[model samples]
Target: MTEETGRTVKPGRSDSRPHEDLKLQLPSERRIHTQQPMSVTAMSRRLPQLVRRAFALAWRVDRTSTVLLLLLQALSGGLGAVALIATTATIGLVATGRIADHFGQALPSLTVLGLATGLRALAGVAITGLSERLAPRIGREGELTLLEAATSAELAAYDTPGYNDKWDAADRGADVSKELIGDAQNLISSAVSLLAAASVLTVLHPLLLPFLVAASVPSGLAAVRSARVHYLGMLATLEDRRLLGLLRWFLVDKTTADQVRSDTVADFLIGRYRQAGARIDRTTDEAAWRSARITLTGALAGGLASLTVWAVLVWLLTSGRMGIAAAGTAVIGLRAAATGLQGIVGFGARLYRLGLYLDDWAEFVELAGGHRIDRGTVRPEGPEQVEVRDVSYTYPGADRPALDGVSLRLARGEIVALIGENGSGKTTLMKCLAALNLPHGGEVLWDGVPTRALDARAAWRRTAVVPQEFARWPLTARDNIQLGQSLRGGDEAVLRAAALCGADEVIGGLRSGLDTLLAREWWGGVELSSGQWQRIAVARALHREAGLLVLDEPTSDLDARVEHRIFHSLRAPARDRAIILVTHNLINAAVADRIVVMREGRIVQTGSYTQLTAEPGLFRELWLLQRDRGRLPVQRTTTDG
Candidate 1:
């Protein structure tokens, strides 16, 4: 068990305690698939396709930059070849002792060499500038595309474990776009350099080509093996990494700052963070050792290959098959070739490794794109009548349903209260009514037509919801309320809504009133209490001017006086709008025109508060419980009204 926010958490139910799961061993059944790393052959086979896809994406982002980058790389390669030829000529000319005769040839060779060097340097500079300009655009485009897919997907998509795993993978993958672009640049440069070296070496001697290949083989194999090991290790610890990140946030963020210190769980949290860090350290160490062993073996093989190549070059010179000047040129060519080969091999390995993440990004985008919510073309005005017809919804991978075969109707100009215990489907039902979640087995009809037939965005515009977990936007109080009615500009309406929810008082007390920033982390910003934030959320919802207003525990944090004022103000809106209020506070529900009592996943009773109090049901039992606890006023009983 763990202690958090002065509450005890039981085993297997650590949701209440932030980062508690980081300290516990996850069950085997809960683990995601632990697959083996791809072999070198598999990675090689897929590299070309992945490279093509990545290049296509980059090209689409900025054509001019892509073309310029390729041109620069190609020009640099041409300069490298010219420099090698000039070096060979200079070496051959210098071999002759007579300065007067050789001066003509050597001077021109030196001039050509200088020109090649200068051009290559200029190209390199241009490449760097272009890469810097292009990388951010590529990253932004990729991230925005991924965001579009994520935001357009149905709400139910987030409930599945598979979707969540893919989403995380995609988020990480989005970062790879910038890295992949840089890798592609390296890859092009290296490929061009390798080709230039190979061409120059072949001109010197055909036998030198094999030596260059031999030199690159061992290191290339080593890099591939290392990449696989590292990638697999990271994949194995992905969940741990996520937990570690969360633990770090909990330790540092303002949201958990008070609870962590007040509850005195800082030491416990830090211990868990260290443990997670240690696990990652162990995994990394093991992978590094494995890679080191493979690299050591490859180094030995490469050394032997290099020795054989040098021996053959010596034999060629000693046997008079090659002149001293030619031998010198051969040596220079060999060194350049080896360097070029190493660059190509190293870049190839990096690209292949990064390709896996890029593939994940691609797959996630495709999957999410396919599952986009098709908000139909039919625009919906404020719905006068909404009906839930035998609706049922079960979360992904869960055996039990969150909402069973339940049906209800809501009409404009009436206040309907839904009261139930925790996990009694109150929240789920409210989400369905708001058109956020589609029922699995039935339909939600707006104006006697299925909601699926209406434009989702348009339908959502007609509804306002104060969710149980309302977002505390870190903007000015005025901006927060304005966000609800973004299509309109009504400073008067904003103030009126704030007044209705008693949020006007909260704003007036602020250092800058409506203009004050809500985030404490920012300059001249201040954080409000939970109750104050709830009032702001209420004002935001009320400002929407939505015909259907769904409030799920909207007053859960308000004091008695504030709660009374808010509930009383809700009555004025109820005259033209349909209000569905879900709360545990029975006193608030008492004023509702009609109360619907729910138990488990089903609505067990429906009647006015007075009618429910006189009956023997869950509603009566709950009211008596609150009354005995002195939470409900004794004077406001069924006997009075």
Candidate 2:
């Protein structure tokens, strides 16, 4: 039994094509059948499950806020009913010339009305306060989840279009717990009023009750119509919302402002803002126009219902079947009931729309269940060769794989140097071995044990990577290095890491030394240069007890003299581990135990520097290019790599 439709449908490209509009698609299991008896038993069963989950999430923070918000929500509905009845009764008393009786019920009713208003207002305030408090905690949790997924998602998932959509659409449902609870309160308020009004109206005139419900049809439809329009409007221009968010950040952020003004980039920023604002304006304008049409439909429905109630009242009055005062009061009560019903519909629409966000949020949080990652407890028994299988990787939404059929192996305590041109997939390969990004098709084996079968994180613990960009935590220097070690009370380890990475003397010169806050955002704190920051990042990474070390352009930001000294100090210790160094500077290649030269995602040559320079290939070409540019003779160590 298919449901009746109010609008014509457009033809799609093909039935096999996945729908881009999320709302237009039906949940195959939850499709409605209008021809059947209107039984909501299925929907009702699902409602409690959703509510219970929402309540559980809300309860994670504290019990007080949740309980209080629900209480205020339910109480406010009862008060609205009392206020409506009292007003109608007041009209009746005044018509009958019983002025004193009007004040009795009316004054008490007004008091209830005021109380309800105050509570509702307080509830709004409380929700805002609670959400602000929860945002950071939930954000931290979400960040962790995101970091884990982005770093360790299945190799194939990263290469799929599905993951791409999920990655970009994340912000739409980011604030789930807070918004879900807040929306529940609104829905509860509407439901409570509908229950009260239905009870009161039934007792007044049972036959008229059906007519009241019938009159609600237009307004109820209009509410749902408005919500659909709002959702459509938001979806049509999501890039605009994202752009607006970014533009606002750039305009107001202290970090971006200096560059924004000095580099004449302000015009560019303003242009972006203008384009984003135009899109938002277009979307909102269409919604506002549609909203006007819905508002008119609702108004007509209410007016006709009011006319019906008055006509009924007049019939009773003129027939000498009821007093004028009682008749007037009944008419007022009937009209008030109609309005209350409409309010229920309006709020119900809000709840339905909020459900969209809620559903997306549930899916995002439970992405963990989707992963089902299997991890091993300890590293493949002992130090063995690091072997790369028939590896290939393709990034999400890309035309071709980044690497193809690549295989390599390195024994323990060997230094391997990788030299490649820009975008030759050197960084990507390094990230794979470090377990930051899983490969699209291939396996990495440690001591003959497949990494996929081992505890990925625990394995990662015994590895360190100096990635292209290092994260600068807004903390003191001491705390930054301390974060690397799992064990507490490792001041000696922190000091040793800092000393080994050429950061100890620089840190000691600060007023607070290692205790000094490294971020300028804090009071009395100072910022460091790029080279200084990189040194700190290296020290932090070195603080960990890792057997395999990957250094990706670690000295790129430093001066030539400093870099020369760093290599001299770092060589012996780095050689004791299975170290892989990635550099554009080929002068250091001579010192490595083996040099792997890559070009355009394929390993073109591999040998010692003395052997590779004689081969006519990429390594020689790049070396020649650098030499032509007068960037070389960079203090070559003359060690046989």
Candidate 3:
């Protein structure tokens, strides 16, 4: 619950809230996780886990197309073998001085070559087109997976750095998976080439085939090792990489634009930018150098094996151990076999490398799957009774509980205000009430049912949280509200919510109103003042069909007059639903049915305005101070920001 939205709004106000005496309160409870970062060796240990995801992606795609594509590559490779035989036959005829007479056979062989080439081209085109189609589907699946993970994530996880790193890794893995079809196509081609070579070599000399196949082993192993090293390095660099994003935002973001230009912090950021860039450059250079070294060794080994075959042939020729024609075909088959093995090794290595990342993605996908909500019909129906009993929580890797032992109960349609100073657990407690967070201990009972047993997504369906830092969507004003509702863009419900928040007028004044995108990045888009954006955000939250509304400083950016007016206007709806506001404004505390003041994660006072104000404690002192401060000239007025 938020304190700001409980206040009324003045219908015609165009100024910012100017009450320095008024402030939003904190939550009475908090939950935090305390997990440590995974060691570099742990991430390294997970590389082998990626293979399953790669195979899964390939197998789950259109199977018929996969089979057809492989068939086409096989046809292409068979044509190559046929061309070789035709040329060799022609060579023998030419040596016998009879090639010119065999023009008819040559014409048929050329015709077969042309058809095979054309078919291969068609298969290549089909595979490319199919892959393009499959990419969007894969991307959609990835997004859905990510959304599920985010929705199911423990509330305290949002306050941690590990969550961000895991998210970045998962995002990269998804992107790579979308592009993996190209690698799959290459693998198919390589397999066909190897098969063709093997068939030809068997006829020439079965003994020579193993050496060609064995030559690719070193390159395959090197590629796998290189991929593992690269992934491990990437995992270790998450902190520095995250710092780079922050540095960019601090330097280049539009909201920060004014700050950097006026505060002379651009120079400071430039130094950080240089440091981050140099670090990334060093990593990149090392990886590239290592890859080059591996490639050289693998190539040298392959070349050495090739030279050995030539030496064996020369020895056999000198000793009269093999015929000239047999020797010639063997030479041709060995070269072809080596080429086929190269394709196999190349594809195998790439697939193996890709497997490492896909495994992480696979784990991410599994994580997302683990969080899938059943969307149960069980809901907090009539006369819901929410009780927070002996609840306590702490953040991950932190020692102190953000919220200590706290307990409270509320009936349906009750409007309560939580008042506290900064750092108190007011907001955190409210977030818990909204089911955004769970109690680290004890329970939050919904309609007398323990929240721990309730479906989290279902609880979310009946609740909406408009925090102090609300989201401003990079879309039209209409879309901002529509996003909150079951309906999408251009719906009448969207305009209605805008009207309720007094933002319809702002949209009407725009060049294209609801159609105009709000982001500068979009064509025909425009930016609004923060106050106006806040109003729109309010409307968006109001648009949601929620049974419980938790607004944390929802009107912090609003004018006092407007706040007063909105609270007055929304009173009817507020009385019909469970409304809890977290605010420190004594004026607002006066209107609430009851006020709960928190301090140091504990509820120090809870009562009606007169009850708490008359007591000689924290609430009494805070009220008197605000009451006296309202008279100061330096104090902000009701009109200006």
Candidate 4:
């Protein structure tokens, strides 16, 4: 889902017209477009920053390798210069017009030239070896860095406007981080070669240096302009590309595969994919046309400049301003300079564009995607009591608050059931209580200390949550229950938790029992029914020794017998932890020591199930409706706090 303009566009949902928002005119995109027809001055200003970032990233990944590769490139350039000088000496001796005498005189220069060329080739090989070794390590490091920053951000940041857009862009940058090393190396190599060639040309004839610069300037400008066009196009198509990815996921993901086939929506999804792709293609085509035009213009200008440089060389040689040997060497220097210039311009352009994407990555990392959780340092082992004092929270772009001035308390040895209709804030209140969502107004306190003063990670370790949509991790059955926290009893603890949630039966039937992988996509792995997965999720929470246990619609997928057994088993765990249960099913609420009936983000009534049922309020009203439908038996036992 893309969050923009203070709202989220749900996946697969778009404007009535398929192409309505395909071409984004975001501030970032607009800025890139406005900077179009990129000038030499602007490119020169930007190139150094990109180069520095590239080298910095490479150096961080493998310091010794990065230094070695850089030295090899510099040595290659120096060798090229030495070889050129040696060529000049040989040519000058051979130009004496005395064949046998000059041939003997040229042998030493020939030996020097051959030695430099061989050494340069060996250096190139070493450079390639170092780059190859560094690329994957660099790539992994880049991705790990991005993941660390993303994981540190607050959960609410995912809902903030433009956050997902920047995330997607940064993600793309991380995907190609290895290429940054190559681009940086090529830029350095080309730059060094350009300098070497220019130095030779200046030594041969002072005027030749000016002609070399003149010939290179146009193509360099064109390359920069082309890169800008490509970057701008990427910005324009960002949303469409994301949309296409969403469509592709829907088409291919196992979760949606059955629905697509059974509902015969494959064609519809394909059509959406086609439309999104077409939109991207249009932007890409426009960019290609613009780039082609710039390149053709540059080529034409460069061709004319090259002709002028060659004419000047011939004039110098004819006028005796340059000798036969010097002119011959000048020709070789001219070709070397031209090749070096092309490499510099071409690689520099690519490096600059990739840097734009990397800039997004760097910016996101620095800001922690704009909403990193910055809580206090005080760590709490567990909460004996959690108090909510008039806490209120409103989601971003929301018309109404999800929770408003709601006060409640949870303590150890108590099972407090929060009963509410959809959108009545039971889940939100639970999240606030767990410190997952800090309130905008008032505060939640754990053992007399405000949640804001608690170290977020440390506090979270003391809370176990089972939401309506629980994660189905692709791990071993035992690992799923243990969740990397092995208790003193090890397998015995896992088995006990599984037994409590009735997941032992599910595990027993698996091919590898506790060691069985949960994902069916892998060999020797298995998939579970929705009810079975719920059992495993419950087992996971039960296994964790947390202070607060928040279960939202935990029994939604369970059978009646399992649901009853699970709720009845809660009391044992509640003795050590504060339990907050949220469910629409009134029957399950009967298991709680205290029942809180919420309506429209406010607590309307609070009492024991029997006490609430005796009164004529929202709780009784809901009970009667369910009791009449035979969904709730009138003779269910109630717990006393």
Give TM per candidate: 0.89, 0.77, 0.83, 0.93
Q: Per-residue lDDT tens digits of candidate 3, residues 1-641?
A: 22655555456643355433211121121011112222234323432343334335545666565555556666667765665565455444444546677666566655655665566577667757766666666666666666667666666666753555566656777777765666656665666666775776666556566766666666555555555556555644555677788888788878789999899999988887788778777887787788778788867876777777677767765778765655676677677666666665565556555655555566656664233333235565532667899888777766778789999887656778888899888888988788777888878778777766677676887776778888878887777776635565446767766776677777888888777788875565798888788878877777777777776776777788667755665565575467778765677766678788899889888899889888888999988898786567885688986
How does each model score on lDDT? 0.83, 0.67, 0.67, 0.87
Model 1 residue 587 CA deviation (Å) reads 2.4
TM-score attained by model 4? 0.93
Which scores higher on lDDT, 1 or 4? 4
Q: Model 2 segments beyond 4 Å from truth? A: 1-54, 64-168, 246-265, 314-336, 368-383, 397-399, 484-489, 521-524, 614-617, 628-641
**Which number leads on TM-score?**
4
Candidate 4 per-residue lDDT, tens place, 1-641, comes to 33444445556766332434533335565376446666678767788888787778888988999889988998999999999999999999988888687787899999999999999999988988888888888788889999999988887787677778778877888877888888878888888888898999999899998988889988998898988898888887888888887888989998899999999999988988888889899999999999999999999999999999999999999999999988998999899889889988999889878877887888778777787789999999779999999988898889998888899988998999999788999998998899988889999999989998889999999999999999989899998888898999999989988898899999999999999999888665899999999999999999998999999999999999999899889988988999999988898888899998888888989999889989999988888887785655466567632
Clash count for each candidate, listed in order shown: 0, 4, 34, 0
- Give stretches of model 4 more than 4 Å off: 1-37, 630-641
- Alpha-carbon error at 142 in model 4, in Å? 1.2
State the lDDT of candidate 2 residue by residue for 1-641, as single tens digits: 11463343447554444455322222232223212221123333444555565566556656676676566556656665665565555555566556676666566655665665576567657756664554455444545555555555554555444454455444455544345555555456556666666665565556556776777777777776777677667666665776677778988787687888888888888887897789789889999899889878877976786577567657767887666545554565565566567655665566556555555545544673244354666554333567889888877656767787778787767888899988888887887776656666788777777776667777777787887788777888988777735455467768778887778876987789888998886666878888888888788777776767888988888878767766666665565567788988898677677899887777888998888888888888888887795655565576945
The worst-scoring run of ten residues by lDDT in candidate 1 lies at: 25-34
Clashing pairs in 1: none
Cα lDDT for residue 164, candidate 4: 81
Selected candidate, larger TM-score, 2 vs 4: 4
The list of candidate 1 runs beyond 4 A from truth reads 1-40, 369-377, 397-399, 484-489, 629-641
The candidate that achieves the highest lDDT relative to the unseen native structure: 4
